[model samples]
Target: MQKNKQWNVKGAMRLAGTFHFLHSCASGCLLPFLTLYFRHLGLTATMTGIIMASRHMLALVWRPISSVLARQHDKRRAVVVGSLFSSASVVLILLLFPSEGLKAESGRCNASQLNANVAEDGGEFTTLENLPQFNATVYSVYNTTVVTEQSNDDDTAEYTPTPLISNSTRSVRKVRSLQEEHPHSEFLGSLKVMDAQHQMFFLVLIVTGFWEFMAVPLEWTADDGLYEYLDFVDATDRHRSAKIWKQLGAAFGNGGVGILVTGLYCLTGTTAEFYSYAILMILTVPAAALLPLYLRKRERRTSGGFKALQLVHGNSQALLCAVTVVLTGMASSVVSDFLLWQMQDHNATETHMGISLALAHFSQVGFVPLAGRLARFLKYHGWLLVLAVIALSLQCLYYSFLWGPWTVIPAQLLAGISTGAMWWSVESQCEDIATPGTEKTMFRVFELLSLELGAGFGSLMAGFVVQKFGLSVLFQGTALILALWSIALALLKWKIPRQRRINYSRLLAADMTEMSESDSDQEKDWLETAMDDSKQKNKWTMDKPSK
Candidate 1:
């Protein structure tokens, strides 16, 4: 029995690891390249910002609604599978949208008609000058025509007669007539092109919004379901081990797809990012379906959100942590949304971006195991957060001075501390303060809500800044903001009294006591009910003698 139980545990871990790996693979295939794809469709920086911001903002609404519906219906697995499938389907729909059609139309319209007209004139300028329709002397230089109109009063008109030009100006007179007659038509044509581009922009925006709507619930549901299952199996300690698989999967997916796309791009001038994303997502459906569903009975707590707010409000450190998280999210969003765009502008290939991102993920994997030791060395998670923010500020400052695409590669190494360690510290601190039953609520409020809000606002701000001042200014500005914010956090950490700080050991003791008391009360109730049943049976037996 012991051996069989151990085998089941191993099997469950393997199943979870597989699911996380595939899910991360699907995400890495497309997400990093999504902004580049938007650029391929000719979206400006401002328009791209709007789309990205809208997705994050809408996620704030969709996440909770999806959570509630899934819980009420008890369909967490169904939700995960359906969300993945739907997200894949959305990618296919995105492919059907027209790309660069307006630009193509404008290109065709601007083609030079002068060459054909000159060829038809038989290379004879004298014949063209003698024609009644050619009263003006057209001197064309470099495709530009200077028309010298002859007045009926020859005495008043000044004309400098020169040697006949060569084939270059042969059809200048004819080309000038065409332009004169169709000026309004050309102006109206440009308006139509602009209008078409705008139409395509809005269409892509709507599709992207729907994509986020389907995709937001995936992480929340999958993580929650897996955590609950681990708890049921008494292997909650293995949760972090399972997450390591996710990071490895992300690294492989990102690096592998990067190399794949780079090869394809060279051969065919096309990318396979969307197709790869769809395929990977479809592959994850099976793993997601087979994941363990322990369904531990949980009492519905309507006041979870209220309690979460109260905890943050009552704890000054927790409030500061929330603010720091928001700032971190903003910094992260700015980098994720625009880093590739900047690299592309600097002539960076698809491979360069892919390898850089893979390195970042690898760094994350490396840091996750060391997070505890690092926190201990720093003496507090708050210090870790502050240091992580400082690292991010330095990274952003480095990005602003990029001389080539390759230069950005080294900056990504900082992602380990800036992104991975920072998030770990934030989660650890939040976990320490979270009330036992409201753990999920606290995470949602501090991690998800704050991050999303920061991301949305940052994307919006970045778009306008990039549009007006360029990418360099945007990066430098973000660096400055983060640097100032980190200093403020450090000051707060020093000024706050140690007595007022949250004590993790005390909180753990309280939580353990509460759990024990609840279990004992439940046992007592069961014993009382059993006693009542026995008394009833005895009374019935005693009364049966009369019968």
Candidate 2:
């Protein structure tokens, strides 16, 4: 019996680890670069923000429906596998959309023209303000020169020119060109750009919405299933251990794909990030199927829907936790959706962003084990959340003052505390508060819903803020909000007396007792019914003999 129990525990842990690792691997491969990809496709900060916000908004609607379906139908594993497959399919659809943006192409000849003129004039060139026509003519001549040179040579020679436009000068030239173009030409060109931006925005919005619809449920459902399985096998402590593998997977995925994209970008001047995302997601589907999913055979008397709300309403600490989660989510979403954009503005490469994410995830491997000890030392899980929020605020503040792409590295190291440990605290609290039958539903509602709701609102606001105030102000503003929120949270914790911890072990024992008693009663009733039927059959047989 001991051997069998040990085998089951080991097998469950291994399978759970594999599932989390693969799922996180897929996330790491795509999520960090997703905003960068949008930028590459010529999406403005505002458009990207709207698209990301829409995804989270849609998730708020879809997640509840998914949770109910999984619970009522007892299909957590099926839902996980199906969500992975659907998400993979959605990523592939992104490839079919036009990758090139009209805006990105308009300035292609600006640098070449400037470089050629500078070379010809022995380092002095005409001011850009007076050179539109000259530059246009130079652009034509430069292309012609390159073609003639290539034709004359047996081997085709490539002419690559470095951009000489200072950032301020480039902006001035762009605005001046827009203003100085022939009125009708300008109108027509502006109209064309607007039409394309709007078209791409809607296309990306729809794809992102569908992608989130499929991807978001996998996390909650898989966690619920794995947790239930672990609880059933009396190995619930191993749940946190599984996250170690998840962190490792994310590290490898981000680092490996970042390197891959960087190398490919150098060679081909384009990235294969989306294709890599699709492949990783597809691979995750099979691993999800291998997870140990515990499905309840009997329906609960209490409905799973709105249970999280009920818990929050009844428990003061739970309410505080929910609010904290929302604040954390809001701050973190702004960072996740736009931090890379900010880094790129500072001339950060894909490699820098990738390494930053890789280091953050790798740090989580060390932090996950320490979460429990920290919580213990603090005397409450909520304190860990408070610390995490502080760390996040500091991270955002650090991001606002970035001097170079490499500077983003140190900030990412804080992710272990901000993201990993924060979630660990949240999950631990949810487990403590959840009732036996509604564990998964409560987790979905409390953790996922609150986080996503804040994320949606944050993204919506971030887009406009970034568009109007710039990335620096956006990060600074986020830092301010988080810092204030954390301070308030700490004050509240000090003011309120701590609630006595619920004895979950006793609760579980009582729940088991009720179930066992119910089973015994059911067996007794069945035995009585069988005996009565047997007696009736014998009586009927005796009467038939007389006939």
Candidate 3:
């Protein structure tokens, strides 16, 4: 609790907020643009799906490989190298290829014997009249494809691309000189070119992923640390009492931050001169970096009626968290991108978009604290969960049927509220179900994994939706999926009981000494009552009621 109170308004909290901002901004910028770009390349539906699948596979491979490399080498340098290479590849392709609808650049190679008319003296090989000469043949690789059709020594025809470039998947061609090049001559310089016209396009994806890998650790480290180092210890009132106030304060502050983000988004609409997305990414970094420092710097003990973190991590919670994590594990570019496009289609002006966004974020303010109060809030959590699910279902319907951008904004706003409520319920549910001696670190990982799973699911759905009915059809499909999602969650919500939840958070907190009391006896009693309520919501402990 002391930690929470101190962290509420401090530098560390601000850092956390900043990190969230950057993460969102970076993710938001690319998600909206990448899909639109591939369509521009004239890629077919099958090709697009293949590309999307490759990216997801790469993301899964890259993270673990990157992690292993970081251990053996300098982490920062490795990040820099990966990012630099990724960026350079894009820049190079863009500079070289003029974007005139996939023009093919080609050149012809010819060889002629050099005519050396030597003077009477052997040394005078360079006579003015018969200097060795041959015209350097030049052909526009940009116009015609390579010709491999069999013919006489002087014969050639427009290259009918063989069984290659037909697969339609992105690939770089690498041909080696094994048997045929003349041994005495140096290898003819390779006319390196990609099969597809826009080689720079896929590079955009690589650059984005590389940067995300670089940025993730910058913020997640602090988050991961909280769960690993602090979760179990903070389960008790003695150490955590000060932190609950901070958590409450954080809830409000986070809501305020959401408001601020919306305000900024509105102030600078999508078509404005500024790179709005990039600006958001830059601003978010510092906000997230300082959360840990702020937590450690405060000087006073915290005293207040604050919610306690539940200590018991259970099997159900672990399973849910793990599933969520796996779903979200790979990079989620598709769904995120589709959503932005969906929003933009609704004529989301800069300022108007922010309002919707703020609505979405503001809905989250109370959920976190409510999760903290889970010992008492458990059975009731099911109700909130149900409510959120219903709202989510409504959101999908609204999106599917709504014609105007104006209509969609309201649905988006509803999404915000549903998103917050659902997340909070999940958090609390996990705490309620925690097993004995569950570490803070493990809890944090579990939570993140669930989010990852959700994102991945969204990503998978996005690719198929666009290919099937185009954008208009995609909205309807998204609605149907979300409807299914809501129904499933609602059924599960019915099974969780509130009284049991309160026992877990409430009594567990008291047993652990996490409550903080004021010096005054009356104030102390009030704090005790609040603690009791907190325990009731968070604990779900029904073995035996405290005397």
Please give, for residues 207-279, the per-residue lDDT of candidate 2 as tens digits. 8887888887787677877887788878777876876887888888888787887676634333467777778
The sequence of per-residue lDDT tens digits that candidate 1 reaches over residues 1-547 is: 2455543767888898999999898888888888777766656778888888998899877887787667666789888999989999887777775454111111112213211122233322122223332323232232222333333344422332333323323444444455588875654443332334466678888899989888888887877777777777677778778768888888888888888876766343324888888999999988888887555356453437677888888888888888888888888888988988788766677788888888988888888878889998988878988989999999899888887868987888888999887878767776777866566678778666456888898888998898788888999999999999999999998898532335545544554454677674564545568888899999999989772
Better of 1 and 3 by TM-score: 1
Candidate 2: list runs displaced more than 4 Å: 1-7, 74-77, 99-194, 267-271, 297-305, 431-441, 504-547
Q: Across residues 1-547, which tens digit of lDDT does each residue of candidate 3 receive?
A: 2454543433433444445444444443333344433433334333444455554544444543453344334343334334433433332332232221221111111111111122333321121112221100112232222332133223332332323322211122122242135433323312233333234345544554554454444333334333322343452323233333333333333233334443453342112211433444445444433334213222333311111222223344334334433432221233334544455445443234434444444445544454445525544554455555566656655655655545655665564346556555555555565444433334454444434434444555666666566655665555565556556655654563333343434453563344454333433446668988889977767656888
Backbone N/Cα/C clashes per model: 0, 0, 85
**Better structure of 1 and 2 per TM-score:** 1
For model 1, the stretches where C-alpha displacement exceeds 4 angstroms are 1-7, 101-194, 266-270, 296-303, 498-547
Error of 3 at 405 (Å): 2.5
Q: Which segments of model 3 are wrong by more than 4 Å?
A: 1-198, 225-335, 343-355, 366-380, 436-439, 442-448, 488-547
**Model 3 lDDT vs. the true structure?**
0.41
For candidate 2, the lDDT comes to 0.72
**Evaluation by lDDT, superior candidate among 1 and 3:** 1
Worst ten in a row by lDDT for model 1? 101-110
What ranking of all candidate models by lDDT puts the best one first? Answer: 1, 2, 3
